[model samples]
Target chain A: MASPDAAAPPPTEPERWRDLDMLLSRPGNLVHSTFDPSPVLRDLIGSYVEVLVVGAGGLGCELLKDLALSGFKNLHVIDMDTIDVSNLNRQFLFRIQDVGKPKAEVAAKRVMERVSGVNIVPHFCRIEDKELEFYNQFQIIVLGLDSIEARSYINSVACGFLEYDADDKPVQETVKPMVDGGTEGFKGHARVIIPGTTPCFECNIWLFPPQVKFPLCTLAETPRTAAHCIEYAHLIKWDEVHSGKPFDADDTEHMQWIYSEALKRAELFGISGVTYSLTQGVVKNIIPAIASTNAIISAACALEALKLVSGCSKSVSNYLTYNGLVGTHIKVTEFVRDTDCLVCGPGTLIELDTTSTLSEFIKMLEEHPKLLMSKASVTHGGNNLYMQSPEVLEQMTRPNLSIPMFELLKGTPFATVHVSGMAESNGKKVSSLRKLRVAFKGVEEASKMDTTESS
Target chain B: MINLFKIKGQKKEEAANSNGGPPVKKQSPGELRLHKDIAELNLPKTTKISFPNGKDDLMNFEATLRPDEGYYLGGSFTFTFQVSPAYPHEAPKVKCKTKVYHPNIDLEGNVCLNILREDWKPVLNINTIIYGLNLLFSQPNDEDPLNHEAAAVLRDNPQKFQRNVQMAMSGGYVDNTHFPRGGGGGGGGGPCYVLCFWLAPPTLAPNANHCTI
Candidate 1:
């Protein structure tokens, strides 16, 4: 060895990461930090910044490892999923033997095993299962979920932090920033949502393509493709033969029954293209997940987490779309906030019949185009107007659900009503709170409107 | 951290499976998870979930969403879900049973929610899909629509889209699409009808004038 004392070969594998570390105290990037630079940057990142990575799938596995390697010690991950036989390609953390185990717990265990001094608390439960207080514990939230609903759910959860003052201005201190990353085949995006500061997920809900819905008539009459056959078997045939027994998608025997029945239906309709995977895909709506796509998105998310916690660099303005399919292309666009967003913007306006009961008002939310809430619990001035969750509270509020709208808001004027309940964001159920300006049509206003309508 | 970007060729469908098929030998992880989701369903008061075939058929159920606001106010849109035993791993096939005029929804009841197709992931539950269906009426997307004509109108002439939505909900014809009647929150004797429709406890009066407030 030529000169044993010569700079120690740049600190070797694990420790080498400390050399160009953003949070390292040795003054590489601390010179330009926007906020006051902490003297103990490494310690701040490790002990002070609490990071939460939602989802423990392909990208989740990568995020855990990347975050661990980047010197963050206190990490927590929550995933309402278990490892599947198919997750092996991109979800490197899991092995063949670890199938059917919760992703979060296993990911935490695996990461800690590989990296030293990192304590990851893995909560193997639904995002909704956790209380609002549980989410408040994290300093930063990183998302690596696949479903739009999950992303939207987490997005709304983060945006839910924005509390508006009397002037309709967001309370700055309550703003929660979320780093969201997603991948589709070779296309992926990493976005940062600083509740009040940046355009939220709901603000840019238009960005996502509308959900896929098959026409019922096609399934009912003009069956043309493999999907139609699968649907016919699942929707009609099973019910005809097995009146009281459920057709389980996970059951091999049940699936086989559907597959065969679908084959017969396909033949009957002269519709071909029903394979096992197609059966699974049509029934379960599964898309083939690629390992590499998950990796690229995960890395982007990991860097975002580091930037968010360490304040090493400016966070992504709002959104960044990445496409690796047609030669690597990354585009950054600043999506403007929707001023009338029901989730993160000013409260929406609602006009209702003053005499309508509280129960009727709740029903109206489902029918209302602008406020199609499937379920809701209302509150005014800190008093629970009605609660739709938790058996005990639901029972307590059951009697009040029948109370008329006018009686419920006796003292309030044409003011905004705060409603809270479950909303589907992306394709996931997220707890959402919205502000709706309720102006009940008193008998006089209703008659005036009726006259205006007829004329 | 996986972004559930759908594979291009992949297709999706939702089903509240029939309680008829081969006897479920054992509950898979997906079914177990689905059970948890159904048990913890947080649906709106106006929405109703019913297993028409009875308790044994958790797989096939009808979820009705009655929007009480927006253009579709007082409209009841029912969606049938067929849950596969492979749920959580695969999304349930969902279809709109009601025919209405909208940008994202076709007259045939095809929906355009990403989660039901390419964006679906195993972590999702029935509750999420139900909420997704709820979202369609509240904020109908004009882009990437199944009803291209409606989407075009929504993009080019929003006032007209509103009118169309109103007509569709009232059980009328919108551009040759004959919609069924009822589900309309008509302004005529509005409060009276709201009272009559809900079948609330007989003690309640139909008119707001009699209220104690």
Candidate 2:
């Protein structure tokens, strides 16, 4: 008989994760083609995998709960918004007392208190404040972001880590997977993005509708609706009354002043329904967040993340949308990636010596047969290495031109640089951003750094 | 050749200086648009633009309109224009500095021009507004009026409205409302042809002075 000490530790509450264990341990016919079922697969999720939850609002709160209960033990959440009295209805994890606190911190604390054996780290800062290395640490990223800008930023960060061989095929090991979910009123969408394999956020950016803007004349003069009145007070009157004083949407006093002024304007215009809450909604551009919609979307996102990590089932084909306005309607669409996508596809590869200066690089870009750029503004990993405009930025980054490329890049032997310049398209000079993969020769051991397949 | 980079740099410096103190403010899109609008302003010969607070302060200015032929003909009216920094987006607030007995111009000096109110558009610039104000003098619409009494008089009796305007231009009283002396004399002793033109009110005459330039 095996010694008791050598035996595997007893499973804690064997029934607690019975459903998850079943899915991970015994695969069904619908499982992914690469899926290999085993009891160890369940243990991998609890022990090794690290998932990042990128928001702590409505969908974010539900995602934390769903992911925690689904055997993802290590989780991190980041949010820049503080909880408000208005967030109480949909953001379930936050209570009345938690108002004025960071949504991430409060949500993390609440989720940890409810779920056992789960560790959640909260980052109470903007997503832009974090370093690229911080994002690279996560095995899977689950997004519950509201804005297109934030989604695009994180998507670029994940895609920034992708690499390709000489054949322009993405290296499987370098692809960072992301599951994104968003809810607006009774509509929501859940999408799975495997950086290089699937269409990234930027590829289908047109899916989002442009924001509605009231004509300035309507808001200033006519003001037929209550919204026009609120917009008038928020956009025009506030500036005219307080010249030099910027209206902070977050400040209570400023909001109160706008609300009162809007109310007065509404009364003058004989338009009703101008409330303080409505004023905040208009000023902040708040989307009507429905809790049930968030719940459904977050569940979909969590399942996609699980399928991606454990290979228990085939993930949703790129994108899934839900509409609950009239009746429950759900659909999944297999979206294709853009072949010439600037964000995902491997950029034009350039080989150069480590001793090449930044000025030489700019000149090379202009003279390169494929690039043929007129004037270049270069950035690496979101940091501006050299800029060619605005005079101030150009002057500040001018000194970098004299420094060696490797010295500017510091530790990395190879990195992707994003360059914006005037390039000829259809015989006309058009400004566009071109991604370039720059590899410095003789900087490190060539054999160890060689990633391109000879075949 | 226009150096866009150099012009942008100078604009940045000007924006910083105009911002006065502390925070170095960048030139906002609104300011840039306003600058273009002001540069492209095409005013009529009947109208004149002046910066009351000097050239540096473009936000506040005054415009004087000398109508050559209309009910308010030969009457030079000054309007104080307080333009918000949100120009073109928000119509400039204009108040008549010279009081007159007209259907659109109220006792409170509010001029009720459609473009200045409900019909305003961002594409309509200071030039369009100046032309609209001049049009108000040439063809005063009695349909929508801030001064209800004057509108009723203009609608009920055209001749009575003409006499009242002539009395108001000569610093006389009509219906107990006192009027200030205007720019040019439209008194009984003026050019006989001018008085004859006043009788017609030159409703649709090709009066180049007030015609849309």
Candidate 3:
């Protein structure tokens, strides 16, 4: 939003920025080694540091407000989900009128309206829909995602940008820091993932517990618990009765039918505790979200983003867990990075002749002892060199298979090529994505020769 | 330490069994599912289920199959099932107690059944799995075989495969792999019969041996 008067000069130290100025202007022992105590640091945070909030849900709303008030001006938020009445409890930025509107747009507008001078751009699209270059534009990415799959996807995307040098050391400039915050009921966690320095989400994927699943037999036959009954109604009975029609959990009629069915099953089996709300919870797999928890978690995430960009203090070693349930418990755990991490690490390096064709490289990959990839779909820097699936895509990219490897890779000496195909893992065929560092034999020498000729 | 815990558990079960209408302890969803599945079971005349740990401990049971028709006819194969509390959600751990020559079942009693692995859905009950196991005996799929040699023989030479099955069932060695005598006369009974019952601790170890029928 533009200021009402163009001639009006910006406030030197507004009351809203007083708290932020105190931290940035003062000299402190905890500040980063490269940190310079100056007013310019405040300006850097106010206008220069571009931060992207990955979700516009519970924590997203809080993050936008916190970051804006912390003197961050350039903020972008992306979310595919629209605002729902159910999200009103914790997602305060959205109102009853804004129910069907895109969460990112509503959240951005609300935050911008409340906090003047803070520019918030909203992208109401899936995270995967955005190109790799789109993610690279932001200085820092703050994730407020709830789904593990989404977190993993964004984590891989962030780590995908990291570049390593000749010595296998990660280039600091290429490290796109991510502050991840998650809340479930009264429990929450905030983690700073410096792609190359700290463990990426994939490295510590074991931290997430596997989803709870009830066997179909149990639901169909003997449902001992209320949840089993609900799941029975939702999973089996709905499909049997509906036949061709798919059960939409969001549909009021569909949910009502499920609830009634669940109640009847519970009654038949002498089971109790099948409520309408409980049925919704079971079908949607809703995690109890407390507003206070979101605020607390988002605050931690926003502070980390500030510390990372401004070098105000060392980022919380790596992870922080908060439990406000029984009393209040907060713990910080430091996690180490995996050097051989397929996502973050410089992948297995392969030297190729400049004249080698894409099809020839695929043949070499199959024969290569380290990577026996069959029917490999190759992509270099988001460019589809060749795709193995979806007949149409495969047909479109088929012509590129005859193109020279260097030409497909833009004649770059060192490039990361992602090849996905069926590979044997633990004696079983599994689809695997392998990142390979391709070094063209003569490209580096040719570039050096060009420099010499120009000089 | 585990034995002590087992003893304490056994004492509790004994108390509940003596007082029995139903056990004072609530049945888990898995146990309830197993009970319903067992109650509604339409087992083939050749198949029989037995609660080795008695009816009180339904989670751990045995199913003995005497294939009346097929290459495995007159040969009894027993499998022990250890159902978890998470049953219906998770597949029951079924292990073949009696080993015999088969393309789909390995020497270690690991049956290569699709439903028991990735294809297992909650809607599938104990009956479906038993039927799948029975089908394995009758058809002996060579495409997704566990015993590679047996699969190769079955695929390439039928007479040799028949000889291997006969030799293995009658307690002989085929290609250096010894098989105990499992074949008796083919037995038939009414469907859905519990052939045997024996009281054992809930923590009864799965014995890798044939059922004493």
Candidate 4:
């Protein structure tokens, strides 16, 4: 691609993307004039560079078009969403015919058909469905998602890509740069996250205010509102009726059941305004998103992505906030990166006993307050300490789960184990990959601890 | 006037006595939290609430505010608070029923309060919004004002604006225009008040004998 020797018709919309070529032709670019005299270095950035755009909603559609028009030839968009009639007002790439169709596939197809010489690969699946290897191919990952949990999940995955030397310093080569854009009403923000260098999403976790919580007494003694009834059904009645099965918000039957139970409670309480939409909103914690805001934020995200990929100029120095409400107030703030960040920095250190087996360690991971990992696959120094997938790997690792913790550590004082699993975040099941530093202690300490606890 | 604080307690007692569908009716987290907020409501003495429809309509109600101190002292302004089923999670839709010559309050009665809009968070209870509104009367923010004219006047000429406010409050002429004593109608007095205290023949109305509005 750098040579432009392979005969692929001259890049379409050459005039439209002429400035982008000028950017790559600058001395700072990797494929700049030092090596080749041909324009392939400029062209190589387009065809060879792999960029993954996560989410295919309003902002996602804008990112696809913006990235395509910016001369990004290899683009991949992944979204586990269908085109709903509600999405039409802002998601410009979709239409009435596209309703019920996978947003990623349709968005990709529409962008390809509209923008010439740009190829987009669409993955119509959840981000968790794809393995770490699937994400490794992308040079830059752009996030246009509305869900905070989803953003954190991706952020954790990006940080999980980090590898440390013997001195416990993050290797720069393994760092993944992520550009995230979020819009709420006329307010939006675009943040550049080069894990270990800039603040990862988790570093500013407090930036997102806490979710709404209700008192159990109010829920039990006095239910006055429709939300009360919905919560009653969701939290209490569901458990009362279906004991073992977890309540799935996406399941139509489960939702309808909740709605009916809520309506009954509402009627009994003499409360009104319990609509289906409201039920879904309360259950899912849905935010009302506006279109133009999405477009503005997504444009910033895409531009930042381009800047990251092409060294066009200094990227948005960490974070950019846009407010269209009060006469278009845009503020760029450089948030201080957290040095003790669990995702980007050295992980939480846990002291373990040599007598503790891998089986006990797995149980400990599930019980740990900070981790609370319901499911986990452990990796130690790039080796599969344990895997729950691909039956053969699981079989091979199952034996290791019973082995002594000292055997796994193999004379090491401390071992960094990577755990990938799902955690209950914001009341939603979100995939999280974390690095855990385990220091093995003597067998006497283990037996002493067990005796003290048991006694 | 509906005592909203007692509304939930009575409802629970009534449900307990009735032919119950289930032994226990569950409440939403938001509802439970809002109930706590209502129980802990420390409303100012100047404020009062009444459900125009009924106590059953806790989701919608009318709240009257009497500014005890400010340029709007002795003036009573009413607002409607529509609590969505989402309650604490969603900010209640609050709109002034009687318009006033305030910088933060628009001519159409739309208020310029941060808690009701972008700055709203789940932790912000109705009490917070009440305090916010009360603060607006005492110290209105002219910078982010919805009523630009009022804001300009308040910013440039405080004394003249105070005179005009006093004049308008007493059902008298400030410049060349006269305002009805009870309601706010300098320019933007929309006809949305289908029923209110403004129904009485105003002192400023010349054709009050024949006019229905």
Best by TM-score: 2
Cα lDDT, all candidates: 0.66, 0.73, 0.74, 0.68
Docking verdict class for candidate 4: incorrect
Question: If scored against the real structure, what TM-score would every candidate get?
Answer: 0.56, 0.64, 0.63, 0.52
Query: Model 3 chain B: which ten-residue window has the lowest total lDDT?
Result: B190-199
Tens digit per residue, CA lDDT, model 3, B1-213: 011133335446555644222111222334444544654466787787776653346578778899988788879988889887556666787766676677766554555565565455666778788887787777775554446678779889989999989998898888886777874322112111011111111234532111121
lDDT of 2 by residue, B1-213 (tens): 112233335445655644222211222223334444443455677887776564334567778899988788778987778776445555787766676777766554556654565445555667777777788789875555545567678889989999888898788887776777873322121111000001112233443222111
Candidate 2 collision pairs: none
| lDDT by residue for model 2 (A385-415), tens | 7766534345667889999887877656677
10 residues in a row with least lDDT, candidate 4 chain A: A29-38
| DockQ computed for model 4 against the true two-chain complex using alpha carbons | 0.01
Instruction: Per model, state how many residue pairs clash.
Output: 57, 0, 8, 2
Which candidate number would show the highest lDDT if scored against the true structure? Answer: 3
Q: For candidate 1, give the lDDT of residue B54.
A: 46
- lDDT for A240 in candidate 2 is 50
Candidate 1 C-alpha lDDT tens digits along B80-147: 78886445555687766676676666544446565665456555667677766776777776545556
How large is the interface RMSD of each prediction?
17.8, 17.5, 23.6, 26.3
lDDT-superior candidate, 1 or 2 = 2
Model 3 regions lying over 4 Å from their true place: A1-13, A357-414, A418-434, A444-455, B1-213
